[model samples]
Target: MAATLTRPKLDVKSLDPYTFLAVIGKRVIHPGGRRSTEELFSLAALQAGQKALDVGCGVATTAIQMARRFRVAVTAVDISPLMLERARSNVRRAGLERDIEVEQGDILGLRFPDGRFDRVIAEAVTMFVDRQRAARELVRVCRPGGMVLATEFFWRQPPTDEAREIFLGQVCPGMQLDQLDGWVRIYQDAGLSAIEVRSGPFEMMTPRGFLQDEGLVNAFACMVRGLSHAAYVRKMAWLMPRISRAVPYLGYILVRGVKPAAR
Candidate 1:
C-alpha cells in the first residue's frame, strides 16, 4: 500500500461541514452531480495514462473514478484530515491504492513541483480561498498545454438583497459566489487560455439531485442519517426551501482553462 502523501493538522472548522455531509452518507458534496463530472471529463477528454491532480478532493470518489474510467493516476489532496482519512479508506476499499494517492494539502499552495500533472481539477473549492491564487497554483502545477477543469456554484442571476441575506448570510457566512463572467475572468486573469464556463442546475442538495449523486440506496440512507441529528435536520429543512427560492439566481458552473504550451 502507498503511504499517505502527507498528514496535515486537523482543522475543526473544516471538519464540521464535510463531516456533517459524510455522516449523512453524502459522498459527492459538490453541485452538478455525476452527470456534470462526466461532462467535465468529456470536455477535458480524460484519457488513459494521464497524471491528474484533484485538489480539495473530498472523499476521492472522483479520483478513484478517474483511475478506473480513464486509467489515470490521481493525486487527491484536501486540507481536511477527516476528509483525507475517509478518502484514503475509500481508496483502499476500492483496491485502487496504486492508482490514487490521498494527501492533505491546500489548493492555494500545492506541494507538487512545477508542471507536474497532466490534468488538474478542483470542484467546489475555489470559493473557499483566494480564487486567483488558487487558479495560479492550478496552472503552475499543470503541464503546459494541459487542461485544468473545475466546478463551482455560480450566481446565475443577480441575487436580490433578500436572497443574499437568507442564503448567503444565514445559511453560509463568508461564502464566496461569483457570476459566470467573474469566474471566466478569474482564469483569463491567471494567464490560462481557452477558458470556458458552462452552467448546470443547482440540485446538489435536493432529493432528486441527491438520488442521482448518491444513488437510490445511499440517498435513502443519507436522509435517514440527516434526520437522525436534529441540528442537521433543521438546517436542511431551513435551507432547502430558501435554496429552492434562490435557484433562479444560482447555478453550478463547469469551468475549463488550458495552460499554454511553453514559449
Candidate 2:
C-alpha cells in the first residue's frame, strides 16, 4: 500500500477549553486507565536507571508508572496547577515520592538545566504549543544522544474542508494535528538527528466508547432541544456532538527522535 500524508487544518487555540475539561474529566472518571498507561510505557521503551521527563504529564500516570515499573527517576511537569497537584498526590500514593519529581510548568518554557534528562516523553502535548518552539524545548532539556518520544493523535487522512472546520473551528478549536512528514520536519529543524517516526493504531476507550453508545444519541437529542450559539458555552454545547462523532476516525502517531551523541 502507498503511504498517505495527512495535514490538519484546525486552528489549535479553540481546542483549549475542551482539552482542559476533557483531561481533568478523564482523571476524575478513570483514575488512570490501564490500557492507555500500558500503551504509553511500551511505546516509550523506558529503561531502568534512565533519567526521564514526562512533559504535559497529565495526572502523572505514565511518569509514576515509569518510576515504579522501570525504577527510573522521572520529572513530570504540566501547565495546569490542578493537574500537577493530582499528579503529586498520585505519585505519593504510589510511594514513589522519592522516584518522581512533580512540577508545574509549561512545556514551551521548561525550567531545567541544560542536558539534564536522558529521555523526554510527551503524549499529546506538541499540538498545544507553537510547533517549532515545543520541538526545540523538548530537545534542549534532553542530553546529547538521549531520546525524545512523542505520541500524538492525527487523522489517518486529511478531512474535507467542511469536515475540517466542523471538527476544528465549530467543534474542537486550537488543536493541531501533524502528519508523519510534518513531525519529521519539525524534529529535524529542532536539531534532533536520527529521527525515527512510526504510526500506529490507538485503542481508545472512554470517550470513544461513550460516543458509540445509545447514550450519545439520547444526549444529543436533549442538547438540541434548547441550545444556542451566542456564548462560548453555547458554542461548545453545539460542537460537542460533532466532535464526539469525529473521534473514531482519528489515529495516534508515535514519533521518536534522538539528539546526536556528539559532533
Please report how far candidate 1 places residue 89 from its true position, in Å.
Answer: 1.3
At residue 153, what lDDT does model 1 achieve?
85
Please list the Cα RMSD from the true structure of every candidate, rounded to 1 decimal place: 5.9, 10.4
> Model 1, residue 189: what's the lDDT?
84
Looking at model 1, the pairs that clash are none
- Misplaced by over 4 Å in model 2 are 1-40, 201-240
Give the residue spans of candidate 1 off by over 4 A.
1-19
In TM-score terms, candidate 2 sits at 0.74
User: What lDDT does the true structure give each of the candidates?
Assistant: 0.82, 0.67
